[model samples]
Target: MKPRKQTRTISRIMVPTDFSPGSAEAFEYAIALAKRLKADLILAHVIEPFPYNLVEGMAFSDYGDRLTPPVQRLLDHQSKRAIKEKIPVKTRLIEGAPFREIIKMAKRERADLIVMGTHGRTGIDHLLAGSVAEKVVRLSPCPVLTVRSVPAASKPGSGKARSKSKGRKANVLKDKATLI
Candidate 1:
């Protein structure tokens, strides 16, 4: 019989955030995991470029201009909170397709874990690059821990959930096992 191989010691955790409530919840999960593992947490947000890049007369566009700041603010807020808690935190906001940027960042940073949100709003004409979380899971170089969507009826302390979870986290785990 083959022995069950152990995973690598986690030193860095990459969390890709789209600033949605689900991603925020995922951040909470990542932060908790990082805290427990004594690993550095990286908050990554990808600024996907505008589709149909230019306007005939405009020569340029304000599409991305209006978008970047608010997302950066979200990233900063999360990073600040983690740092305040004495956690080693880093944040990266890159301009590119969300999935590609996330996967590249994970590889470059050598992240031991990639924690991401499941469903998020689509972007730039709803490009085929749908659901950044799904793509990352398909392409990530390391383990991906997805914080699954919570059912609308299952509040934190509901008796139905409390019984089934057996003290597991209230949020479901939609583990994506693709290793590309």
Candidate 2:
């Protein structure tokens, strides 16, 4: 019998989340992987510059105020989870394009892997906006793991009395749920 070939061992994992269900699922996977590998995890969220820089008179501070709460909630919730689980964790918040910021975080952290979610936006949406996860995969210095969100039917809290809530962090609405 041939011995199993050795591959890379993960040391640090970077996860850039938008606080979507897909991102939540990716967090679960990353936590499990980090636990097994004894790897550190970095959670990052990006506050995307207002589309088209068309701030339309919005002040940068005001824009930040509008954009940061949700992202902060999500990041804080996930950070707590990692800490509770005893996974070494760090968090970062930045304002920029999602893919670029995610890649930058991975490089800055020297991450061995990145686990994140793909919203699977398609058709006009994909054409007009493009996919952040796709860009990350293409440009990431480390290996990327993209997790697609499950359907609503299979999503957490879907069939349950209550959906899996990020607790207080679940206060924000979806659409542009959370960011840095």
Candidate 3:
């Protein structure tokens, strides 16, 4: 009998979240994949620093009272949940532009892969607003997987199905794979 070869490629996955629905989907997907692959997961949230002018207006004590505890609580809660679910995870909160911070963390941690969500904006909307997922996919040292949410009622052959077909066609042009 021939021996089987294992083809699993990911050892660690970094998922950056803003606690949005899309990010939540990415988190869930990452956890499931990690469980199957027995890989470690890192959950990152980047808090962009307030503008200098804004920071200058606040008292140091006020800033501390208003910011640190809530942020820490959120990270602690998420980390505990991941551990309780039996998925090895490390939670981090950094200060910077989300895309740059995510990329920096990924490289620093030597993450094997990144799983993130795209808001799926286009044209003027996309141009006026840049996407963290798009930037990460373009600049990250390792491979990035982007996930988008599909509506619940869009059955095959329905009118909504046409939109999905168009999305798939666009994805081919954009080089995105819908893993879910």
Candidate 4:
């Protein structure tokens, strides 16, 4: 008798967003991919907690009045709105570093892949500020798909705009071809 062969299925996909234009593009791409693959999509955002001193200075009355329920409600509403009329999606709002929260959520949900955006910074910007997508790609248990927003001039022909099609580009993981 022949041995049974096992096939892997991509059941879930995790998408982490910072709400930037690049992230929004990634969200749209994730939605399309999720629909095509028949996979569950998780749309997540991380709200870093208020600084310790800020929290410490607040009085109990102020804390009760200003915090808790309202924030939870707002997150819930945003998540619902983002998911509405879309493919099967589960939304989450977590507290921590964005990359950490993303990885943690992916593990918790047992996601098969993660899709995110890169800011495409260069020179001092790229050196001084690293990317969360880069870090996540290195550390994530699942495969990471990093999407780069196409420059306005690069879309078809913008005439005067020269294409940097050959040189080394930072913040772009892999190549522009990977996006399609």
Q: Model 4: per-residue lDDT, tens digit, 15-129?
A: 8877776776666666656666777888787776554535677764564346545655754554563366366777777666877888888899998888887788889998897
Q: Which candidate number has the best lDDT?
A: 2
Better of 2 and 3 by TM-score: 2
Better of 1 and 4 by TM-score: 1
Judged by TM-score relative to the true structure, which candidate is superior, 1 or 2?
Answer: 2
Question: lDDT tens string, model 2, 73-114?
Answer: 878887998898799999898998888888888888899999
TM per candidate comes to 0.73, 0.77, 0.73, 0.68
For candidate 1, write residues 72-151 as lDDT tens digits.
Answer: 88889889867866779988988888889998999999999998777534586347646677777788899888775555
How many clashes does each candidate structure show, in the order listed?
A: 0, 2, 0, 0
Q: Candidate 3 — which residues are off by over 4 angstroms?
A: 1-8, 59-65, 151-180
Tell me the tens digit of each residue's lDDT in model 3 across 140-175: 988898877544454347876545553132223233
The residue ranges of model 2 lying beyond 4 angstroms of the native Cα positions read 1-6, 51-57, 154-180
Taking every candidate in turn, the Cα RMSD to the unseen true structure, in Å, is 5.6, 7.0, 7.2, 7.5
Assess each prediction's global lDDT (C-alpha) against the native: 0.75, 0.78, 0.74, 0.68
Candidate 4 Cα deviation (angstroms), residue 106: 0.8
Per-residue error at 106 for model 3, in Å?
A: 0.3
List of clashing residue pairs for candidate 1: none
Q: Where is the poorest 10-residue window by lDDT in model 4?
A: 164-173
